[model samples]
Target: MSTDKEDLVVDDDFPITEEDVEPRIEPAKTNLSKRRTIDNLLEERRLQRQLADFDYDL
Candidate 1:
């Protein structure tokens, strides 16, 4: 379906501030590759658990 341009918002009710941004940390150059691989493996495991009907009750 075609949408009207008026449906989009142009105003920024609550503008983002500098404090809202988290401080960046510089990672060790040698550790960067290993860190990314580990992160990817962890994400894969989490997704597999979800697909297998695993649940973490509150």
Candidate 2:
């Protein structure tokens, strides 16, 4: 069952069925490439910082 709300409009000829009135999950991954690039950059910076800190600690 869908948790989405639908508008209650009075239609005398409206047909109701399980498949007819159901919302489906869209198989979409929006902005994944951009997100991955940002994540990789952040991870690389973290590794570089860690290496620098290790050299200073020694």
Candidate 3:
């Protein structure tokens, strides 16, 4: 068992290209918008539940 650095072997079959490394902006924006919408809906629902549970006699 040799611990030399030259013993490492890399496979050339799978190479990283520019398209694979580039960031996709449009999909990310849509996903973020959808996530925000869901978050807003959840917050609204939670607030409504709290309002329904409030003690009006106080």
TM-score of 1: 0.42
Query: Can you write out model 1's per-residue Cα lDDT over 17-56, one digit (the tens) per residue?
Result: 9999998877787589889999999999999988788656
What is the clash count for each candidate, in the order shown?
0, 0, 0
- The reply for model 2, stretches above 4 Å from the true place, is 1-30, 55-58
Q: Model 2 over residues 1-58: C-alpha lDDT tens digits?
A: 9899998888799778888866865545646766888999999999999887785644
Model 1 ranges with Cα > 4 A deviation: 1-27, 54-58
For each candidate, the alpha-carbon lDDT, in order, equals 0.83, 0.81, 0.90
In TM-score terms, candidate 2 sits at 0.43
Largest lDDT belongs to which candidate?
3
Q: What is the full ranking by lDDT, best candidate first?
A: 3, 1, 2
Candidate 3 residue pairs in backbone clash: none
TM-score, one value per model:
0.42, 0.43, 0.55
- Candidate 3 per-residue lDDT, tens place, 1-58, comes to 9777686687879978998897866787899999999999999999999999999998
